[model samples]
Target: MAARTHGPATTSTWAPPSGKPPLASRIMRATWRGLPAKRYDVGWEPGLRVPAADGGPLMTDHYFPRAEGDFPTLLVRSPYGRGLPWSPMYGVLFAEQGFHVVLQSCRGTGGSGGGFDLWRNEAADGRATVSWLREQPWFDGSLGTVGPSYLGYVQWALAADPPPELKAMVVQVGLHDPHALFHAHGALNLETALAVGTGMTYQHRGMAAFVKATLRLQRRLGEATTAQPLRGAHVAALGGEVPWLDEVMTHPDAEDVYWNGASLGEVAERHRVPTSLITGWHDALADQTFEQYDRLRRAGCETSVLVGPWTHTSALQQGWPEVFAESLAWLRAHLYGDPSGLRPTRVRVHVGGADVGGADEWRDMEDWPPAAVVGPWFATARKDLTRQAPADRAPLASFRYDPGDPTPSLGGPLLSRTAGSRDNRTLEARDDVLTFTGPPLTEPLDVLGPVSARLSVSTDTGHADVFTRLCDVDPQGRSVNVCDGLGRLRTDGQEASDVTVPMSQTAHRFAVGHRVRWQISGGAHPRFARNPGNGESPVDATAFAPVRITLHAGSALMLAAPADGAGPDTAANG
Candidate 1:
């Protein structure tokens, strides 16, 4: 199993000229002189405490220009430690450009006080933190926020009802709703949830401890995921107390007030700041990032999005240069009134497959899911993806799904493990997974936005899990998954005619000579819980049965991709 990238890619669409002024530059600029190379000597003030409403003084570290003058404040709040790259890159990097960078550890983590309750108190806490910054003599009231994951969530929490002094926001892989991450399809992502809970709770155990815990996890993850009664599996595998993990186990629905009330979507109607979102096609929270951006755009908040061929950690894997210059350019425009910082491209997505030298390979679009060339390539009896639907209704495809021996998850938006695209040749060889291949493309096919499939099926079990994968098949027969999704079907007795499973979104170009492939399966273990075929929670269930699934001839895979640059009749019929 060779590692491949199922995520976003870099672009050559735009680059800033060396020592050139802002506004006229590359899409993902590598070099820039817009901000002075060094505007001020850098200085750091650590352990500065600010009074929270109920919690202990929130411990913070400050980075600012040495020049004696008030500077625009760039605030980043996170449960992650506020040091090194987190502080130096964001704090000193931006501070050297004549801005004040303030990094604060959230309520319980880092040097901050009080118990951690996830995102429960972030909105109020964030607002209070900003208020404290206003009292500082060196802060000019102009503020912007940055950071990915938890840091990203803090921005939205504050932006729900932004302060009058709030000027701009740079949201990176922000998860708006906890439900979206915890329960992707009414099933807990057992392995991922455990890793996250342990990491967040035990990260403060010092660097050596962190490394040991990570190595331990890598060694025991396989056994932990398959544990019976997964309720306390993390404690046995990770050996740490993570309060929030139990909450996910107890409440699987996002409708719970605990989860719903903390969602950015719930308060999105109140968002009133100019914002920019950055994410990868394969980011764990890609859907959430795009969904939040859509909501923010509809709410009349000036917003833009930039998606690259990368994973959740890729943004800051080594350095956040891709996002660094982008954030600085955006914040300068919105906060400092630098007209040159306004990026005209509302949506910039990378085109993968062929990496063009000196070019960004990014397409500038006004909106997502390009207007023309959508298709629902109907499934046929001969195991082929055809542009035409099969007339025969009697030919049905069948597969047996056994919960105990579920299909393993392969790449595609995974967390903790080595992610991105992995060659699917071996996974596809399984008899349980159905394969449907399309004829080699005669023209380049550029896919953008979401992917979906309508399966005409019925199952003996009360609950059935439908997992479908869309892959790009090269001439050599290597089927690499690009986008995929899972849908959990339920019934009182009657199985629905067609269950629609929504695959993850992607922005890749399938060059001519390559074929498109679809893989239909019953489950993607750990990524999604296996359907027991009987009514039993995975937490304490012991019995399992094989589910017989039938996909009638009318089944089809629906996709939305641009043909020849948004030309007409691009819908896939076969």
Candidate 2:
């Protein structure tokens, strides 16, 4: 193999021979003489049409190590272009660790033929790809899979009825329930779905103008900004609007349509492969990852879960270096003869607010909601409002929700170009936001795991929406959003009994001076489909009729805290 170096040091492109060491081995030996030297090779080649079981063709780009002899392969099936930075880097990393990597473009994506059909055909295509790899000259008959999000979904699909060559998988930020991830709690995730759909469609088109426009927007607004003018531009450029976007926006419920597209629960029950599952606390797909972990564990499958303190993008930019190392180690141990690495049984999560340089500290346990922890927080409500407390009799507070000027999303894990560090103090000042403050805590309170709110409400109209926000109020009265949940109620569903809605789980420390605050309102616009107030379609409803919703204290809002000791070690208000 040819060798080249773009940096100061000279390095060979391929692994050296056993006796006559190559330049790459010499460079590695010089750098770390006492430690193990790692080397890798990279090159690009044409696509091979792997015949699907159903008589279709799936095109794949083969990326195998040039080290000679047989080697285990790491297959990554992705709807996004095979050459996307994340997957390509993953392929290279695995190859460096002494495994061949195959990056395949899913059907209807990239150079692959046929129309896109989501997960409908992934099982057959993935099986075919694995079979083809096993037949290749470089195959060692062992295989593993790795990728995040959609790529992770493909791994899950293939594992459902795994090929004989499949051995292990590393799934990150993947959805186990499409309904929940797409239409969370009956509310359409318009911003995330639309952004992802549009971005992928643009990639499929291979339009330089579209890529340039997207990059410019991403640069100016940051990756957290979700709202964009490109929806119209993309529709115009594509010559028609994408039907999937509309389907998602219109059907904001867990219906058969979505369930058919994603049957992860069933997939997990049937999967026999060992798997490593990773997720972000703030990612939109966190629920899916967690659900998959739980299901796989129940099915008597060997599984490991890792929850990080970052968002979807953070998995790439901030956490990729360490995560990639851990993942590669896992793959190597399972695929190759390396026996030093083993997957953990319990989940390891970053315990935030630990004052460890604002980095996530890993905590291991036997199961979720650790055996020692119990969930027990009182739901105190008066009239229509609710508060979570061990003992409190505070009256219900009211806040107006104006549709004309709704709450702007300030980043917690949605597909948007906005930066995740937006200050939410200004939004807290609005009259439409009802803020309840708790007295300063006497001791440090560690809040870890999922949060929930119970509310008793009545609406002037038959249909209404409720948005609950959990925030940490610092000494300066700046409120930072920690977690949030929303619920839409029909006229009949708005009963007097308290209703429970789950907020995102987080690890934080509420110090003596810091206070826990709950912001109650009706809606978080654009991020969620707007409630029409007239019981009409949320998307097409243009009429801005106002609806009066009441929260009665003592009868309305209550807070449920995790059982004592269930919170993280320390808490820090963001």
Candidate 3:
């Protein structure tokens, strides 16, 4: 099919098209939809095949005002079908608010031609689509991109060499570190690699086929992720071609050219795009979002961040009203040159804990970590995390880790369906996981910044893994996860000590009477692929091996606390 040739302006007519709600009705339905000065009825334009730099034409569907005047464009390009995130309601909502909304399906998905080889194809296609949009009569030669996850990645790909028409972008949970996305240090997220990747196997196929394939893959995902010699098991679960999955499994090292070519680290620094980032404290990409904001700002790019208190999908679902309002304000100020729409702030974090309906209070700060001092809590031989430093080396605290029965994931930052804080009391009961609980706080202890754990340990096995977690122990003794980190190591027949595991960032207030707890474990099950302790890649290893992890007096966990109030016994930095 040929692309739509939008000609010069003609007298436009407004009407509520058949089987669709009116613009006014939709706006009223929204709890927090931005109301623009100009309002127009939306008109749907579908089956528009935009020609790409690649021979294949990308399929697009536009939802725009019926008014005859050209308007600023908001483009969302993703491998996921356009209806997602945007849905029909959001598509019309944007269009009705006096913007031209373009939903483009990335190559090989949503009937667009070409294989979806991940982020590699986005740069050229994104630039070409911008060129095509510039030619359209409805576009005012200004464009703003908005979406979450992969949709956000497409924006970064375009920002590498931004087209003249490109104005700004609203990135939500964007992936900046390709290495961390797949391999967390030397470990792979088995569920993501096997299940999520498998579900995307039929992206090129029609919706029906894709839906059926995804459903089938998910039903057997747990077993598939645990399969031995996992190099090709994901493909088998997909029951169709997933060549990329094979390639990823075979190459577990981040040093691979494939990861370098796709990672957004270098490309982000190369260009400046007025970007607004909306991320969640519990989202898998939370740390990456903050990292990108800092990097972009340092590179002289105009960037603002809003960190919420929700999971990966919940960030989009429950946070739509909030994030969209901020994003729309950002777009209005940036793309439309209306400064009143946006308030400048380097970082706006959701101070977590003691929440109503899981929503935290927001606080704007000059930087990511809000002027906090590093306070350390040392591990004692008596199995307690303390503020006092050990005067002498104490006896070693011991725990045996068996990969066959790795501790189950109680959820913190994994991208599975169940991705958020879960009660950890049950998980802490396991003999393999060592628990170090602090005394009940008589007053509130507000921790806000990057959290990490340093372990001084000696493992009997040549290769071992360490997983450390921070939790809030309530009055009832229920331990809820706050944040956690995992470290994979290869001792090569020697004992390793002072291992550092960088946990995900968080901004939580431990309420009065709530005791802080740390669960030091070897593995967190399939959330992070279990280390076999044999120097073998997790991609192909399922066999469990027992390793004795001996923790000595020097092991410690630390958090960011206010510098103003501290004691002499508190150690500085981890």
lDDT leader? 3
The global C-alpha lDDT for each of the candidates, from Candidate 1 onward, is 0.74, 0.62, 0.75
Q: What's the CA error at residue 570 for candidate 1, in Å?
A: 20
lDDT digits (tens) for residues 313-428 of candidate 1: 77665226667777787887776677575556677776656342234476777766567466888877788999887786554577888888888888888666566778999888
Worst 10-residue lDDT window for candidate 3 reads 565-574
Model 3, span 292-404: residue lDDT tens: 87788778888889888788878767776677678878887776676775655567777777562354467766667766887789887677889988885554577888877
Per-prediction TM-score:
0.89, 0.82, 0.90
Which pairs clash (backbone N, Cα, C closer than 3 Å) in model 3?
Answer: none
Return the lDDT, model 2, position 412: 66
Preferred candidate (lDDT higher): 2 or 3: 3
Give the residue spans of candidate 1 off by over 4 A: 1-38, 356-360, 491-496, 563-574
Better candidate by TM-score, 2 or 3: 3
- Model 1 weakest lDDT span, ten residues long: 16-25
Clashes of 1: 26
Q: Which stretches of candidate 3 lie over 4 Å from their true place?
A: 1-38, 202-215, 356-360, 393-395, 492-496, 565-574
